[model samples]
Target: MLEKDRFFEKVIDRIDHLDRNGLKNLIENLQQKQRVLQLVFEALDEGIIITAEDRVVTMNNVARIILGYKSRQYGNFQEMDKYIANWGLWNILKFLHGEEDIRKEFTIHQQQEPKYYLVEKRTIEDNLVLYKLVDQTEKKKLQFQLKNIESVAALNTLASGIAHEIKNPLTAIDLHTQLIQRAVQKNLVCLDESILQYIKTISHETKRLNQILNDFLLAARPRQLKLSFEDINSFVQELLLLVKPELEEKNIALREEYQNIPKNFIDKDYLKQAILNLIKNAMDAMEKSSLKILTVRTWYDNGRDSTAIEIADTGCGISPDQIQKIFEPYYTTKEYGTGLGLTITYKIIKEHQGEIQIQSKPGEGTSFTVYIPIHKGHKLLDRPL
Candidate 1:
């Protein structure tokens, strides 16, 4: 009994000692822990807020910034509460109260700016709620841009269809006009050569107008591909033969590097038009260069199930800023350019399930690489034995 009483006395003494310094040290340790947590919260890029059962207890600098609260006024959570009342944060808080792991993307009006925030709420062990805010403004902006591009592309397609329908009749009218003017000129019946010249001028102007319309129509329409298994080497050789005279006239040196490429599934006529436009653009850009060298290269890109054809030029390169906008319709840097060639080229390539990539720099040169898928079907000329 005496030993038991002695042990109880020792325990009482120890408890008394713990009452003094132990409480003081415990308070200090908690303060230090809070300071460390504050530092960590301030260092993070994402905004963070910690709320007690009734009110917000702590918030990071980023959170203050996102909430449009100044550093000096951060201690007052009531002001932030009032500001967020209209922004649907109050509703989020209500949801967080009931839910365990909550996530939502919501728009908040802070300082007159409509900011998109991805809000994540997690319930801590102590019943405190941790709210994380991530800004999605840039993501939303990119989405808007993509939507606009799609709309523009659809409009371009519609325009092309209308242009195609108009072109055939325009061509017929142009031809008939030329024939009538020629017959009138041959029959010199009481009319001077000036009158005949006026008729000829009408025919010439109509022809030019027809050409412009045709170019515009082609730009707006999606091309129908006549799928054929074409030998890349033979196709390119034939294309060069057609453009050889023009290149020679311009004194541009032509270089061909044909790699062993598999048969490509392509619309021959549309592919020819695309290549023709690219080569023509290259040749035109080389008019001011000292040594004009146009390189046409074809090879298979092994990493993909397709073939790539590259048309590079040693002419003046396009500007960096202008490169992205080059595919946009009616956006041109040339004096006499209709600005639809590259746009049409892009459309045609897209229809073929192909890709066109351009690399250029000012005064250096430009290269356009086109990738077309290999046809998985039998060759056009292959017959059953």
Candidate 2:
């Protein structure tokens, strides 16, 4: 019996030793995995943020650098304010705190400029939230650049078609005017005032037609931007004043939401003209609408490093099909519409390395958003004078 008991004790001791070795190995493996994860997190290029419950637990270097956060420790919510101000980090944080699923592209106004990010949120252990922010600023600009190229090409084609189709009629009109003038000269005394008035009308219309052709050609061709610094807030205020009389005639309510933003490098004259053209279009659209409200707002987009002007009108909005073709030359719904106004507006904005987006619904309203870069060097497309 003593021999059997000793044997059992030895076996138990051996089993205990093996269990201790296995536990040690498991701990080392876990530590190795943690170290590897830390290294991988540091080396990542995209911004990655991990939070334990509502407090930031760990954030990668890229997240800190890209988001302009200098501190590695952000466990305290209050400590995050300084860096979060510019990144609009509070937006995501708010959503996370609410335990809402956020997987979308969101624009955050950072320092008066708009920054876009593809933010994805996932929860770990039902408490920690991980937010991944991918900067889409450059990608969006590239997309705009591509669209501008397409627009320019279309403009070139339109210009060629206009020169061929419209110039002959203009020439014919000019020759007819000259012939009428010569005939009048030969029979001055017989010419009645009514007949003379008719001739004057013809001559005046001919001159106006010639001017329209000139505008079309100018709009179609590449323009050399005359860059200048201007305060957009003051510029917008002055511009609204000029159109105040017109708005009053239509009983339109003008609303201005102007943010005090810094000056932008822009061609003041061209930009002013473009904005005026847009306002005119809005007025035309509102002619028959029940509500005549024109809202103009200006702000800066920090993410894109640009200034933006948004003109919204509670007018008879455009149909989806017509909206796409609105930029095409001579494509107009109005009987007397030249259709080149918006085209020229598009050209000027593109040359300024800017973007124009229109949102409209038939019988609802229309909003035209124009984005202009703050720096003159942001020329994605060349516009030669």
Candidate whose lDDT is highest: 2
lDDT of each residue in 60-138, candidate 1, tens digit only: 8787776654444333344555555234554555556666777889886667667677889887857677889777878
Number of the top TM-score candidate: 1
lDDT, candidate 2, 1-385, per-residue tens = 6975885586567655657776677568668978998999988878888877668888888777667786655765657866653447555655556667678887877665577778778786677778787888788878988999899788777776877588789889889887888888888446788988898899888877876786687577766777666789888888889999989999999999988788877787888888998999999999999899999999988987788899999989999888889987677888877888888899889878789999998898999999988765335323443
TM-score for candidate 1, residues paired by index: 0.68
lDDT by candidate, in order shown: 0.78, 0.81
* TM-score against native, each model: 0.68, 0.51
Give the Å shift of residue 76 in candidate 2.
71
Local error of candidate 2 at residue 248 (angstroms): 2.1
Residue runs of model 2 more than 4 Å from their true location after superposition: 1-191, 376-385
Q: Global CA lDDT of candidate 1, please?
A: 0.78
